[model samples]
Target: MYDEIFETVVQITHHDYAGCIDKKGWDHPAYFREQIATRQLNDQSFEALMQDYLRDYQELHMGFRRLEQESQRDVGFTVRRYEDSLYVTSSQQEKRIQVGDRIVALDGETIEQAAKRHARELKASHHEREDWSGVLLDTSEVEVIASSGGGRTLALQAFTKLPHTPSYKIESVEDTLILTMTDFWNHDAITELIRHNEGRFQNAKKLIIDVRTNKGGSDLAYSELLPYLFKGSHVDLRDFGDKAYTLCTERNVDLRVELMDQVLQTIEDEKTRHQIDVMVRELKKNRGNGFVELDLSEIEDNMSFDTKQGPEEVVVLSDVFCGSSGDSFVETVKHSDKVTVIGRPTLGMNDYANVAMMTMEEKFQFWYPTSKSSAVDEGNGMGGVGIQPDVYIPWTPEHLDKDVDLERSMEVLENFTHKGSNI
Candidate 1:
């Protein structure tokens, strides 16, 4: 029976973010009861049942598409957001579709309307422009109209290459360091990049950390970059004046307890060990509190910086693609007076974080957000709204052709350097 999947989803969402369920209009007890009966009567497979349920939950309700398959196939081109419109930025070896083509229509809907639909399926910002993976497909064909007013229909297998991007990039423009953080896939890659480029970073007068296309990977990746950003004796992703909480089923609680116990055993430091012990104690103390207060940031007092390295003035280049850890990175740095955010708002994905994977029937796996952003208490953490940039620079087709964001950033740096003006 698919009862386990329904029960687990209900329990998790009910405890974690009942508001999320309510927003979907899936909060009706009788509705779920009826759906359960239908599922049993129909004898639905776990994958089939959950995919349909989550498609409604994610795409219809949340405004973002759910990724069901493991591997992704490309449509011979890449689409980027240019103010709620999806534009073909790059194509794999110029396969049919050329660059600078705007996706005007997809499956009979206008590109703008489809972009909104795509944006709804996202767990991050509701801003339609932030969704970089425009119109993903498995086996279906996507019809698009180019910016040049030409139209063509293509399938997923049309792309000769895979949907791929580099891990990270470091470049030097005059005295400024243009650090392009595309993905946070590897913690070690971040560490190695900093380690290998120590000299270049030290010589730079200003730094522009471009996370425009960063879709977020590991918190550990951003944590590794902290020492460079903050020239302190220690670093901490501390509580920014809010009480954090996590909602979990008894099964999740037990798993967390087990993991905590295992981690506690591995820790040799007396002070650190004691801290973990206290955390475990408090978690168990709260037990069935439904939403128990928890610290989401990792506190590391031992992580020391070079002090002499890194620039005093930093600017973060953000857009709709900057989400999850990318959004969190922006939130962390925006607290500092030295950093100025440029370009569009970040892909606001702070709410409903720390996804926990649940498996049913030992085959179907479900990913649920066990905790929400601390900003939820402040009435500012909706998945649709992103963090606004200090300097609001929206991208255009002209800007894309001329690399306007980079040019504007360099101009700002030049003015800051010569005139001593913050602008």
Candidate 2:
């Protein structure tokens, strides 16, 4: 019976690649179970069948075709390479093109005609079009809106809404600066803030880094900011496990050693140094010579409160959007005595995901951790189980509209400072 079911699945997957209608929804376990129940397959038979089908599909296509489709759909971008720039267009926008004043489809169909005809069209756009020579332009529903000074703004409300400029706001209540970052990866804004606060660092009694909406981006940015917090100190911030490290050092051991030495120099405290050395030695013994460890101990041990010029206290504000490298930043700072973390728990997707460049296919693919991140606080691994905060602050719909997360964080910082004064 299991063999029969397995054979059936294989037939459905292989024989009907384009029209595998039955197997389309089988990527979901619940849907597959419903189908199995409808077909009246027994538990043992169904389990065996699914196991066989999964293994066979993985061996042949690296993973289930249905799953791959689902993943691609979820990620929502199809990447292409032009001469100079990387092109990433959504599957929903590919059918429509925007001409000067009209939106038309690639097949010379109007935007309305394309939408009415196709059930699901790829949302794609040309990213590297130097000149509009070979590119097709579509313009059907273009509206010209006149500004206050008589300048006309061409608004193209095609598949997506019109792009609006984001509002920059700063709410200063007492000594707290509540900065709400809508986009996590905007380096310009972050750099500007760092520069703006360079003077504040010396004067401010307490500094709060609100990364509530910071989803994560550019690990380099996170690393760069560490110097400001740690000054000249170095500490190992993370370990990428033994196997991964060995692979990293296969090309050069001297580079790895030099890197490790550079990292070790950041540790300012002798006691912390001993702890780091012990951990490194243990890792070396267990994982063998070639693993990379990020040293961030210098920042942890050397943070001084006695300095009249430096920031007296540092607080990190977190939310569900905080993940990946943001989580790493939180974790690294949490180890320090000068920093206190407030607000809700993080998004908990803490594992280091690697991007694989498929040279043969000229594409990039990402492989995230199947195993839980050991670097995180024990048992609080990925898949929605995020890091618990020292203080839990829940956000309501009303709070969101009024921007209450920052308010709550600031209140916490103030209260913490006031309470510490009595002690």
Candidate 3:
């Protein structure tokens, strides 16, 4: 398992975006290989060890697609890491533990200590990680200290499947419309939502898009919303004037073929199928080429869309949880003169994108980006730092009960809500 993973990281993975790979001088992999060899680990334990090694990259672009067993599961609550302390952002499972509560300890160890083993170890502007306090924790109890004072031992419920959250939600506060998109995964669903509420969107003076928890899917998922949010006629995917540099290896080309097949099987949309067909053909043409530069500056996709009238002004609510296509949406949308990005920076998975998968011996499957961004060499890349918001509203304990991000948006909109009408 170690050997296979090491080869993938060292040989297969393009060492452009993940600065850690070069920073370490590739010594950690060999060290981890030796360390794992000392232990007699089963499949679950093996992947856990590999995951720990993978964490060194600090890139969400790479991960395990399929596992031998359910090696990682979460305690169905949400926590946000502030400095060294872990705060409960949402307490869905433990009613006793409020949103402002601080997680003192998990099992017996301090959150700082437990997070290394239980949660993902990542360093970013806001390092939010999976609350891997075990599937049910060591014991179904967590030591949560109240924000005001005092502490209580609250119970937790772990989940193999996370609690269901809707793809998109639309709300109106007078002329202002709040579109809360949980994720861009539901391409058709998001498209439908936009089409369904066309009148409400067009009539709005201000649009507040909440993508704080969106993990991202196909960039095309939020395509329909682009026209509404965009204030002008044109917006490009290469908002920074960088071409999408896709690495065309045999593996990557094969993965594109696999993706096309999957799309053909599941997707009924003629346009989507045609897009996939085009992508596969392009990849096939560039097979064995080092890095093929795909010019997205003039691409006619929804990403590089021509705008239509809807909301006059737009405000996007983003957090560290948002990444990949979600990050892409924010990056592209921010280019518009009428858009203001609020909340926190994204998870920073845009350094490398268009992720593809590779299975080794049918034991484990590795997921990695098939494309590299031109921003990597340019040095202005949204890799580690992510897309910084214009009006930075630092997330706080008050954010739990009150929609601090939304409130800030409302406040901003109030100052200049009905100044003009054109989108």
Candidate 4:
């Protein structure tokens, strides 16, 4: 009877995998083969099976190769400094070249066409290697806008301050200090700024940490900064979800036991108390037996700020690029009373990812999740709906060019500050 059902289901479903229809038939491959053979498979069915198998095999192979490339790719970029003249280096290769002498073009056009033409001829002749070959051209418009040394310097400075540019100057308004971090991981300069202001937090009437352009980085660094803002509060900084198993810990057990004790003592109804007690005992048994300890003690100690403060006011600035550790930071901050998040919605990834190491013969590589992460809720996978802000502020091209978001944040802070004033 089971064999007939299995064959019927397979035929209807168009599945081609081989398996026994019953436990007794597992050892008899001939019987199993005969059962499958009873139903004659057509060309279309055979082709479908072959295509499905090939597709799955190819996908598995491609997945491994992608992981390999990600682990091996160079994660570094060139850094150029402008001294008396611009100097650029391909940091990985340690190749250095002077800009003015080599790069004779602004855009596609030449700064000195005759010099560039002659340089091209020399380059073609192989007098110098291509690694050191091309002239270093200024990508900015300042080169043309200011022909002289002083004018060029001023224009370059202004260009650096341009809103759309990669870097910007941080400014303070009233009690609010506006800092926009556009890159992943805090650099030495940013670290120093945080350190310098650590002691001054008490003086701040309100604090705003802006990361609208923050791409993301080390989760440890991002989350470690939270305690400082809170001062002191026994806040749960992390939560984990397991679908198949209930996670347990001494701390979780104690928490459950304490809650149960309270419920048993507080509820006057005998039947309800008895029912609650039984439920608690069953839950405790299941969790106590299965609980796995997660090492969050490290994070607890690493938090620089005291946890005594119940709540403080903080506003997190976010955008689509805020991900990974950035997502963790935003979620962690949302728990505090003092923290009121403002800006556009986040990318809504709340869980962490693991970077796995792989090897292909002699070459070693690693694979990381391009879009794989679990949230506190196991079902809330990566790319889930992101966190929405209390106040929604959209980005516009004009705002990008003029720092409109920063201005809006200031307005919010000003209104908040003035609302408390008796005047």
Q: Which lDDT tens digits does candidate 4 get at residues 121-171?
A: 222211111112223212332132211222221111111111223332345
Regions more than 4 Å wrong, model 3? 1-10, 14-24, 65-70, 93-98, 105-120, 125-142, 147-149, 152-166, 233-239, 295-305, 361-363, 418-423
For candidate 3, lDDT tens digit of each residue in 1-423?
Answer: 566665665565444223333335533677777767788876667766666776666667877634534544566566776656568776665566667778777667775676555444534434443433332344567787888899877777654535457668898887788888878776667778888998888788788999888888887677777777765567665455456777777777887688768757866656666666777778788887857775332235755767777877888988878888888888878877788898888777887788777677677877777776777777877876778888877766677678888888887777665555322
Output the number of the TM-score-best candidate.
Answer: 3
Query: Please, what is the whole-model Cα lDDT of each candidate in the order they appear?
Result: 0.62, 0.41, 0.70, 0.41
In candidate 4, residue 168 scores what lDDT?
A: 25
Model 1 bad stretches (over 4 Å) = 1-3, 16-52, 55-76, 81-85, 92-94, 112-143, 146-149, 152-166, 230-242, 254-289, 295-309
Better of 2 and 3 by lDDT: 3
Per-residue lDDT value at 105 in model 1? 57
When sorted by lDDT, best at the front, the candidate numbers are 3, 1, 2, 4
Candidate 4: what lDDT?
0.41
Name model 2 segments beyond 4 Å from true: 1-172, 179-196, 227-309, 357-383, 421-423
Best of the two (1, 3) by lDDT: 3
State the number of backbone clashes in model 2: 31
- Give the clash count for each candidate: 11, 31, 0, 16
